[model samples]
Target: MHELGIVFSAIDTLEEVGREGSLSSISSVTLELGEVSGVVDSYLLDCWRWAADRSDLLRGSELLIKAAPAVSVCDACGRTYPTVEHGRVCPYCQSADTELLTGRQIEILEVVAT
Candidate 1:
């Protein structure tokens, strides 16, 4: 699926960073994942395992994921609620005018080089 493509893109980015830092090997990578990012953690991990081993710089690297909660802000209520639970509706005031404050994120946080 798209996880494989994401893994490839991450590897490419890591390789570029490694080159810039003159790093020969990477020990681990940390990714900050949002609750509503739509990227499955298990699938992403599997893809990482498969792809990381193929790259010289990331042969034995570990992929770590940190989950971030999905939050939504209600315009009418001026309050925040969990996006996964209430979605676009504000649970407090029952308002349909809401916007997502967080989640839907997929980004690299840190990389350990060896």
Candidate 2:
């Protein structure tokens, strides 16, 4: 699945970073995942364990993910609302000009290394 692919990508990046930083070993990898990023955290983690085991650089690495809350800004009345509702129209002014403020990102934040 795509989760496996994503995990591999993260592991590859972590390995490269570890080498660039002169790290002896990677202990953990922290990721920031948006609620609306369309990724399942648990699934990604499960895939990570499998894929990481295949790599010496990431064999013992821990994957830590932080879920980011969903938020949206309305263009009509300059109001913001929770994007968890998943509505195209703004709840405040009922306008369709709402833009997403956050919760659509998948990023690697930090790496814990020895």
Candidate 3:
């Protein structure tokens, strides 16, 4: 799936960072994942394990993911609500003018070098 591609991209980024910092090997990587990012954790981990093991700099490295909740703001009501619960609709005012505030992220937070 696309998780493999994402893993490859992450590996590339890690390699670049390692080169910049003169790191020989990485121990772990922490990622902040959003609820609406459409990335499956199990799939991403599986991909990471497979891809990381192939890279000398990333072999045996750990991939840690933190889930971020999805939030939406309603323009009509000027209020925020959980996106998973109410979607684009504003629960308070029953309006459809809403915008997603979060939950579409898949960012690397930290990388630990060994």
Candidate 4:
């Protein structure tokens, strides 16, 4: 699954950063997930747990996830609405030209380490 890849990549980045900073252990990884990013947070956390235990640096590491809200702006009305609830339809003018303001992203915000 793609979540596995994402987990591994996150671990790899953490390991690299730890090496650069001489950190011996990692406590947790905090991630910011978009509402419409097509990523399942539970699945990603499960995959991360599995992958973390297999790595020396990440063993016993905790995964923290924060859900980000998706907002889109309507071209016709210049109004913004939650994309997850509206589904690309402008709540103001029912316009199709909606531009995403946020969400649709997966990013590592921080890593707690020692």
Candidate 2, residues 36-97: lDDT per residue as tens digits?
88898889999988988888877878999998898999989998888999566898778999
Query: Judged by lDDT, which candidate is best?
Result: 1
Per-residue lDDT of candidate 4, residues 85-104 (tens digit): 99888988888999999998
Error of 1 at 92 (Å): 1.6
Task: Please give the distance, in angstroms, between residue 68's alpha carbon in candidate 1 and its true position after superposition.
Answer: 0.6
Model 2 error, position 98 (Å): 1.1
Quote each prediction's TM-score: 0.94, 0.91, 0.95, 0.93
Give the Cα lDDT of each candidate: 0.95, 0.86, 0.94, 0.90
* lDDT score for residue 25 of model 4: 89
What global local distance difference test value does model 2 have? Answer: 0.86
lDDT of 1 by residue, 58-112 (tens): 9989999999999999999799999999889899999999999999888999999
Model 1 clashing-pair count: 0
- Order the candidates by lDDT, highest first: 1, 3, 4, 2
- Taking the tens digit of each residue's C-alpha lDDT, what string does model 3 give over 1-114? 778888899899999999999999999999999999899999999999999999999999999999999999999979999999888889999999999999998889999998
How many collisions per candidate? Answer: 0, 0, 0, 0
True-structure lDDT of candidate 1: 0.95
